[model samples]
Target: MTFAPLDPVRLTADLIRCPSVTPAEGGALVLLQSVLKGAGFDCQRVDRNGIPNLFARWGEKGAAKTFGFNGHTDVVPVGDAAAWTHDPFGAEIVDGWLWGRGATDMKSGVAAFVAAAVDFVTQTPPDGAVILTITGDEEGAGRDGTRAILDWMEAQGEAMSVCLVGEPTCPDTLGDMMKIGRRGSMTGYFTAEGVQGHSAYPHRAKNPLHALVALLDRLTEWPLDGGTAHFDASTLQITTIDCGNPANNVIPARASATVNIRFNDAHTGNSLSDWLATHAEAVETETGVKIGLRCEISGESFVTPPGDFVALVADAVQAETGRRPDLSTSGGTSDARFVKNHCPVVEFGLVGRTMHQVDERVELAQIAALKAVYGRILARYFA
Candidate 1:
């Protein structure tokens, strides 16, 4: 059967038409599997925790060098769809741009890579392997997507030498930036317990709210660090503080505050948790109240330092876009954090100015340009 080469813009439009919000397949993965299977790829659909994911590979077996493209079929929920000029899932192309949710924050990126893979296989199959890792749990809790697939790959003894995550990393142009690393994120919740009594009887009750205020002040007062060479300084921000009592005359029995930190390589979740515990103990001693703290880690910071894979992508961007891409580590967390454990991973994609916003969209030209870059990187890595 003769297959027409995939067009990046058309593929992008098709993907955006799916309302594959987080935790929803919306037939996005099925569409991708059909495209890859038609190109002679061995495809597998793996479902974890009801989240649909897929893995596809082509080229000769036992190929020494494997080039992999990583991305997600999931998109964040389109808040208040009525605010969009067109249907959020309409996939409308107006004035040379495709407008829709996930058009930039990543379904478009997935399309570009798929088109690149089609170009690669049709022009010249890789000497090694070309694989795609697509997951649906990226925009949600992330418990059962990329992490699960990585474990499965290990069990099957499948290894990738290098992986590129097609997250929307570009700030301005298609090839202006490439992500080498990402900062770690941890969240902390604290509860200060005290005796409740009439506010008029100041000495009769310990005011937990007072203790909470002092604790938050200290936590946000100091800088976590000056930051490292490739990362920004660690930051802590209190997201919420709650004391349900609305009575003006009653002292609250407890006060709770939640904070989130974005940290660099200088610290780990354990180290920060330890610091929080120490501070909680100090607050307990000073305020004479029991302070309880809980910590949750979203992801640890990671960097894929300058190396052969990084150079390969850089050269490809320069060749295709005539702009030497800037290697950066600035961005929120992505599935790349999970892939970093199996292989060196970096992120590059379309401009992200519209991600997670109303009327999300991507330029038509950028879709084709990004495909060319991915195709070049594949050729250079597997040559």
Candidate 2:
């Protein structure tokens, strides 16, 4: 018996119309769950803290070798709706392109892989398993999204041998680049306290702004490292520094600054936190200002070395698109940072030139091509 082929573009259009903005179900998962369940996949809602997520599996609970695909349904808000060429949730097709807020950022990716998975199993069922982890919290605070599903999977003794994150990794073309890893991300909040007094009487006042600047200068000027083999050199950027002093004649009692870091695997969050503390203490001692430091590490760097699995994905991409994708570790954080703990993970999808832009969109033909790439990967992985 022949099974019906899935249309990813239609699924993408349906998803775009749901308005599944972050922290809202918006019927995106409901549509996906219904489709997966109907196709014989076991579907589960692993929501946590009011955030919605879905887990679908097409084979046994703990298959020795399972393939997993992870993606997010939730999208960033459509800022300044009037600036959009098409309705942010309209999912309109114009000039061979699909226009919508999540068209490229990832509803299309989710749809493509979901379509590929369904068709692969029905047409030629793999000997192992196929799993899809779709989260609705990726565009917001990511605590309850993929993390919640993985927790549930662990409790249920479910696992995937290897996972692919369908994040938009290409920069220019459909098969230009694929991410084998990502840099870690962290932010540091620093506060400097000093006595408030007349600015003209400089000796009587300890200028917190001065201390803060010195500390920031020390951080930004010092290089974290030269660079890594698969990753780039770490960086620290001072996002904001505020003294709250309105009058030029007075020095404020406190000044605060926020510094963000995108580090390589050479440093852990704790190690970098200590580095910031050391500089803060030195500035405090040198300037006699009380300095406080706090750091938040969102994720740690990880890499899936060039090996058979990496070759499989690269070969599949090149075979379909005629572009041998560059294996890269460049990009901001993703849910793969969480999945890396469970299994070896890599990311590939369509060009992301418009992920969070005011007029986000995707090429109509690219959706079909992306599904083909995913389909080839499934065929080879299960073979």
Candidate 3:
């Protein structure tokens, strides 16, 4: 079969046009399937709970030396539309930059890898499988996204030896950084209960707002950990504090506060949850108010360590851009956390300076360079 060179720039534009905000298919997956199927690849829709996903494979399933690429089609909300200088979904390229939501956060990353893989298999047709697992739910509640596909793969006995996640990892320039792992992410919610009363009669009511504030102070002010070898210090941030009572003259019956934590390998979600519960108890005892705590773990800290997979990707980045990429674990959680359980995984992609911002954009040249880097990784991996 004849295979045309995949164009990351054009592919990225088509993806951005879909408006596939979290949980929405936005036609992104369909476009990919069309091209993939035409290239003699086997494709399947791994949709779960209404969230769309695409699982495509070239060569035999469960084959040795299978190389996988993981990424998302869904992007975050466009935020305030009025502030943008370009159409959020226009996929317009101006002055060499492609402007649109998901341009960097990573529609472009997906394009680079897909393009590379298609060209590789059509031209070389690797002895092992090349798998692309893309999900439409990464920017939203991630439970039904990559995790769902892994579950399906497990049931079917499918596996990949090494997986590369195409998340934008470079902070300043392309080939500057690649993530070997990511910090864990979790959120804690606290609700303080008290009697409602008028502000003039302070003694008649317990102030739940005071209790909630105390709880937040305790959590935010206390440090979680100093730092790790490959990661920075774990930190907790107070995200929101709210009381529905708008009246200045009345004390609310209940007040709530939420905190988000980005933890390193020094802590686990279980340990942090226990710590939050203990602090909640202390706040309740000190403020004479009842408090309830709820917690959710988005993902846990994980690393692939420096190994063959890491070296393969880092060498590719260095070869393309002439700069050795830093092996980092500084970013927030990603789908790689889940993929780690299935196979050794690492992340490398274009520079992500404007992801999720109003005028999110990517340099057109970077997209092509990224495709080149990915192509090199594939060529060498299947050699």
Most lDDT-accurate candidate: 2
Off by over 4 Å in 2: none
**Candidate 2 clashing pairs?**
none
Q: Give the per-residue lDDT digits (tens) of candidate 1, residues 1-383.
A: 55577898888888888879989999899999999998988888878879888988887544688888899989999899888998999999999989999999898899999999987887787678888889988999998898877777787777777899999988888789999999999999999999999999979999999998989888888899999988999999999999999899999999899999999999999999999989889988999988999999999999999988898899999999999999998878999999999989999998999999999988898998899999889888777
Better of 2 and 3 by TM-score: 2
Quote the positional error of residue 263 for candidate 1 in Å: 0.6
Ranking by lDDT: 2, 3, 1
What TM-score against the true fold does each predicted structure earn?
0.98, 0.99, 0.96
Q: Highest TM-score, which number?
A: 2
Looking at model 1, the pairs that clash are: none
RMSD of each: 1.2, 0.8, 1.5
Task: Put down candidate 2 lDDT per residue, 1-383, tens digits, no spaces.
Answer: 57699999999999999999998999999999999998999999999999999999999888887999999999999999999999999999999999998999899999999999999999999999999999999999899999999999999999999999999999999999999999999999999999999978989989999999999999988699988999989988889999877888898999999999999999988899999999999999999999999899999999999998899999999999999999999989999999999999999999999999988999989999999999999999989
Ranked candidates, highest TM-score first: 2, 1, 3
As a whole number from 0 to 100, the lDDT of residue 87 in candidate 3 is 96
- Displacement of residue 54 (Cα, Å) in model 1 is 0.4
lDDT of 3: 0.93
Judging by TM-score, tell me the better candidate of 1 and 2. Answer: 2
Weakest ten-residue segment in model 1 by summed lDDT: 59-68
186 in model 2: Cα distance from truth in Å? 0.4
